[model samples]
Target: MLELLSYDFMQRSLLAAALVGALCSVIGVFVVLRGLAFVGAGTAHAAFAGVALAYLIGFPPLPLAILFGLATVWVTGVMEEQGRMKLDVSIGILYTATMALAILFIGLMKTYNAEVYGYLFGSVLSVTSEELHIILVLSVLVLGLIVLFSKELYFIAFDQEMAEASGVPARRMYYLLLTLIALTMVVSLKTVGAILVFAMVLIPASTAYQLTHSLRHMTAYAAVIGTTSAVGGVLLSYAWDVPTGPAIVLLATAVFFGSVLFSPKRLRRIVA
Candidate 1:
């Protein structure tokens, strides 16, 4: 592992995984608690569309994806706030539409690019220093927001009415949280791919959920689990010449299932 880190590509991959893991786990706690897992998937697909558009237009893909992701969050938040449409319906429609557009653009480009496939399935080994820098910045932004607003965010998460009653600007926090999720999805897309981004966002936090009843401790445990799984998966992929995204997700799934199998709650229920 030490020798592998000496290589620039490997170092970049590790750094990307570390940052992505932290971001995903942090945002995932809210995603799970708020029942917004679908939103994460939607934003991920939306980001993919942005990448495809970037490819067609000859711009940097990550930045384009992030921009698209932010837009998606805004639109979805507006629709949700208006209550003119159900949140799931809005997300499903937009998610499919954007993903379809991405596919169309990819075909129109008339190039079967390995880089495109790598993004779909992850080539963390191919992560550029520039991309890693973007991930680092985004991670800081996310952590900063979470730290600054954790009390209010938690109140909103637990009881939106109470949060609003307390002058927490719950709506603003809601949109802000969505925006953070968009950023998190965009950053993790390269490491875990759009298809498996949900795994990264949900698995570690779910496992932590099983281990703890406290939100703070659960968040900490989730971050640790996510980072460990990402790094381990990447190392395993490197050693075995396997795909990185699936490997990482599989590791997360393993942890999730392990938690379910061994959860004390389940055991107590069984005994009763």
Candidate 2:
């Protein structure tokens, strides 16, 4: 482990992974409570589509990815809030369309772009210094906002109607949550990739949920679980020379299952 930290790229990769892991799990607390799992997944694919378009048109990938991801969640939030359509149905359509767009953009490129594929499948060990800086900046921004509005976000997540009844501007807060979800997806795209990023958000929170009924404890546990999985996966990947993305995700998955097997909540249910 000490030897791995001796290298610059590995250091950047570990930092990026830890940031992504912590950010995703923190925001994931709300996502799990609000039942935004599908929407979160859709935003990731939309962000990936934007990355593809950016690579094809020679635009900066970050801006376009943010645009597409935000558009997806905003549109989904509007449709769901306005009662125009079911949230899942709207996001489902956008999800399919965005994935198709991603494939189309990739196909249109005359020559293959390996960097583009990095965003698709993730290669955390390849994280550049610039990319690490971007991740750090965005992670701080998103986490800061979540901390600022944690109460309203949590209130609405538990019961939007009740929150609105209490004058919390539930609609706006819902949009804010969706926006945060979109940004979180974009922030995590490179480290975990579009395909598996949602799992990074979902799994740790879910695992934590099984262990505690308290939101604060759940979030804290998730952060620890996520960070551990990410750093552990990086070490294992370095040792085994396997892909880092899947390694992190699979390690998180294993932790999730372990949590499930031994969860106090589950054991209480069994004893009862």
The global C-alpha lDDT for each of the candidates, from Candidate 1 onward, is 0.87, 0.93
Best by TM-score: 2
What local lDDT does model 1 show for residue 201? 92
Candidate 2: regions farther than 4 A off: none
Clashing pairs in 1: none
lDDT of 1 by residue, 150-254 (tens): 988877878887889888899889988998999998888888888888789998888988888899998899999999999888999999999898888898899
TM-score of each: 0.96, 0.99
Across 1-272, the per-residue lDDT of candidate 2 in tens digits comes to 68879999999999999999999999989999999999999999999999999999999999999999999999898898789899889999999999999999999999989999899888889999999999999999999999999999999989999999999988888988999999999989999899989899999999999999998899899999988898888889999999999999999999999999999999999999
Provide the lowest-lDDT 10-residue window in model 2: 226-235
Model 2 lDDT at residue 239 = 93
